[model samples]
Target: MLDVAINHAVVIDTEKSVEKKINIGIKDGKVVLLTTDTLIATRVIEAKNLIASPGFIDVHGHVDGYAYSGELSACQGITTTVGGNCGLSPVDIADFFARQMRDGFVINQAELIGHSFSLRQAVGIADPYRQASPEEFAAMEQLTRTALQAGACGVSFGLDYSPGASFVEITALANVCAEFNRVMPIHTRLFTQNDLYSLFEVLAVAKRTGVRLLISHFVYQYGTGIMEEALQIIDQAIENGIDVKIDSGMYTDWTTFIGTATFDEQTIADNEMRFSDMVVASGKYLGKRLDRELYLKMRKHYPNESVICFMGNKAEIYTALKKSYAMPSTDIGTYKKGEGHPQIAGSFPKYFKEMVKERGDLSLIEAVTKATLLPAKTFGFAHKGVIKVGSDADITLFDFEHLKDNADFPDRGKPDAKPTGIEYVLVNGTLAVDQGGFTGEKAGRIIRV
Candidate 1:
């Protein structure tokens, strides 16, 4: 008998270019059968009007073992999240994975060993503006090797956070990642709003080091009147045999901790951003637009607090994601309930609603492919992003016509309010979300390259 069965669902086969009504049988955490015939199961999900796609994969996020963030991800139909992004992660990758495995989690996770912050700090370079000495660089390389051996999927960089990370240091670490055939995801070094050079610098690294590169938050980095040019550059790079792709969110505003160089007074001035354009996303001043006093206070007293910087073109968001190489991501940070960007709960839902149902910019099949198989192939997640007889049974079933994202920014509405129309989500053959509500199932596994 099957452990669970989903009946009368229109299943999307991302790899095979097919979407057909099929009955799915799950047994022992895998999809054992896909047929039109009837099957017996211990539990059955009636999904006649629902579209069954591989569970969405968030390619860029910071939900590195935070239970609330994982729950939010699961609620959004994201069965797998790639964390350790933007130059911050647990220093001990092995211990991080081990702990998550020992103490179960709601969704599957894969991690990147972070440069610019975690690796630099681990090698005793505390100053973000100081170049890594030769000895320190060697130590960081060794730590990266250790983490990769311990199951880290890739290496990530937040170059804007570390101004002193030399080109040599970056290439050397990227070379190590290339050696392991791991993808390198980068938050490029851009202090000014229109700095395409930062984008070029990353592309140049991929060109030279031969690392498969994933650009994190493409719209946030270049949506300020330069998105068209940025996409052209990426297109040219790919045309020239440089392996590259991008992940973007639906919003123009991006969030990060107040203490990072991204919010430094000089950096803000360089970007020509005003304090009013910033909003406090987390901490005591949640939902308040930044003024000089509040900004300085948070930077000094609550350096770890998250702030959302509004600085991109709204239309450019779709313009970026319309490209074949671009995929949607949350860029979600660890936040307490009711205090975070709406992306934490709304990204994937919003992606489907806007890109598919509302705007018709992407067909349902194309959107599903980008959200599922694209990231799976990018990160080498062989079994998690497809619907086949032998594939891992991670699936999301949703009603397209009824789907909508209700979560909004803290100032506008509840940031963590869940969306509607996600009927069921299964992670590793267990029902993680049932009947539009989370079931508190911790069936996700840690994926390592």
Candidate 2:
């Protein structure tokens, strides 16, 4: 008998961009059969009037085995998440993987060795504004090699978080990633909203080192009336034989800690961001805007407090994801239930609602492909992203009409509000979300490259 079977569903064919009514059989956490045969299984789900697709792979997230965020990701049909993004990750990818393997996360996690925050600190570089010394570079390079050999999927850089990370330091690590044929996911630094110069700096590493580059959170960086121009540069880079791809979230606003270099006085002034546009997203000051007094207090005492910066044009979100190489991602962080940005809970559902169902920016097949296969291919997860025979039994079933995002910002309502229409999600043939609620199962594995 099969482990599980779903009969009579509109199964998505991502490779061919088609949909067909088909029955699927699963066993041993793998897709075992894909035919019209009526098969018996230990458990069967009647997928009447439902659409079944390969589970989403969130290309940019910070889940890092944080249970609340992992559960939230599973609830949104994300069966796998690429974590340790934006230059913040566990210092030892091996230990992180070992711990997650012993204590499984809610969804499968693929990790990247982080540079700016995690590695720099590991090598005794305490100041974000001071460039890494030659000794620090040597130490970081050794750590990078160790992590990559231990199965990190890529190397990530949060340049804005470490504003002092020199291009030499960056390219040296990029060479390491290139040597191992791993990706470099970068959170490019910016001195201003129109800082196309920063984009070039990131591209220069990709161009020089011959490493594949995945620009982290594209819309957040360039959606401030310059997304079109930013995309043009990416297109040019791709045309010039640089392997470049990007992930964008559905919302225009983004969340991060108030203490990072991103929120410093000089950085804020350079980016032309206003205190009024910043709202406390988590902790005791939740929902409050930053005036001078609150900003100083938060910067001093509550530096790690999460804040939501409302920037960029909302239209820029749709525009960016409409591109061929663009994939939807959730810059999700570890947060308690109801105590983080809505992106943690709302990103994937919101992507489908806004991009596929409502806006028609992408057909259902195209949307599913972007969320699933494209990311899997980008990160080289062969078994995780497709709903074919021999692939992993990671799947999502949803109703189109009811698919939408219910999560709102802290000021508007609940920030971590769960979304609607996602009915069932499975990871490795185990139910993670059943009847739209999390099953509290620790069935997810730590994906090591």
* Model 2 per-residue lDDT at 378: 89
* Per-residue accuracy of model 1 over 1-449 as CA lDDT, tens digit each: 89999999999989887899999999999999999987779999889999999999999999999999999999999999999999889879999999999999999999999998899999898889999999988999999999899989999999999999999999999999999999999999996999999998998899899999999999989999999999999999999999999999999899889999889989988888899988899988999999999988998999999998877789999999999999999998999989999899999999999999889999999999999999999999988779998899999999988998889988889989999998899999998999999999999999988
Instruction: Tell me the whole-model lDDT of each prediction, alpha carbons only.
Output: 0.93, 0.91
lDDT over C-alpha atoms for residue 296 of model 1: 87
Clashes of each: 0, 0
Off by over 4 Å in 1: none
TM match of model 2 to true structure: 0.99
Looking at model 2, which ten-residue stretch has the lowest summed lDDT?
Answer: 333-342
Instruction: Compute the lDDT for candidate 2.
Output: 0.91
Q: RMSD of model 1, in Å?
A: 0.8
Per lDDT, the best of the predicted structures is: 1
